[model samples]
Target: MYSLKLVTFVVLSSIPYFCYGAKREDFDLQKMFEDMGEEGNKMRDECFTENEMSLADLHDYDKAEDIPEKELCFYKCFFQKSYVVDKDGKVIIESIKAIEEVKDLEESDRETFTNCLKEIKPVLECKDMVEFEKCFDQILM
Candidate 1:
């Protein structure tokens, strides 16, 4: 009986191993791009609507010296809002790293970094796994 049980267990384990090694098609890049685009657009629309501001309404500063203390407040608000909506963990990690990066920048550089983050916010909000993988690839690249 013990020998029969061992054989049964070995056969069952082999079945899964065979299934795991089955050939699968390569990832579809076009579908990934489409999904990313769609997720990005939806996130952008929702963010703008919730904040009651158009994308064009984001603060503009002409000089590094021109950034007021209120700009940091805006960054904090944006980070808080965006971080909570991230269903996938990738964006949250990126946002945290970006925040840390911004902390070490000069006033002017901080402004530019923050603006770049704002631009990429929609792309980071993507919750689809395929799109998330694509975004991760792009970030790493």
Candidate 2:
């Protein structure tokens, strides 16, 4: 469970690199939120509060190190609530592809992301998340 936190760090930490210092213009956070819709927004707010996390926390994470427990669970909560992962812990490929960040990706990059999604374990666990983090790092970082 805790190890999943590190994986979440790796996934979100990649944002800084691609977003170029986590700038809104580059990352379009507003658009991302809008894309998330009402349910997703509520989930995001709840997860942020529950985890005591903010965008700054996402920026502060170091992908080279293990992710903190709160942060990891934050991602997991967001994933589950947003239907990125189902109740049974299966990746929802379409939902992931629909994310603003994923939509902004270039065709090849999107394909790579899709491939990574396909590689995820059937039942998500900390180890699976760790592998996902590694895969995300290879693609984005």
Per-residue error at 4 for model 2, in Å?
23
For residues 1-141, could you state the per-residue lDDT of candidate 1 as single tens digits? 233223222322222222122222213211221232343445444544665644444333332233233432232233334452144232444443344333454666555434443444443322222232222222222
**lDDT (0-100) at residue 36 of candidate 1?**
21
TM-score per prediction, in order, is 0.26, 0.57
lDDT of 2 by residue, 1-141 (tens): 223333333345454343333233523532343334454556777878877876555433344235555655666677676555788888778766656666777888889878977887853553345444554665566
Q: Which stretches of candidate 2 lie over 4 Å from their true place?
A: 1-41, 49-59, 100-104, 126-128
Compared with the true structure, all predictions reach lDDT values of 0.33, 0.56
Number of the top-ranking candidate, with TM-score as the measure:
2
Error of 2 at 136 (Å): 3.1
Worst 10 residues of 2 by lDDT: 1-10
Quote model 2's TM-score: 0.57
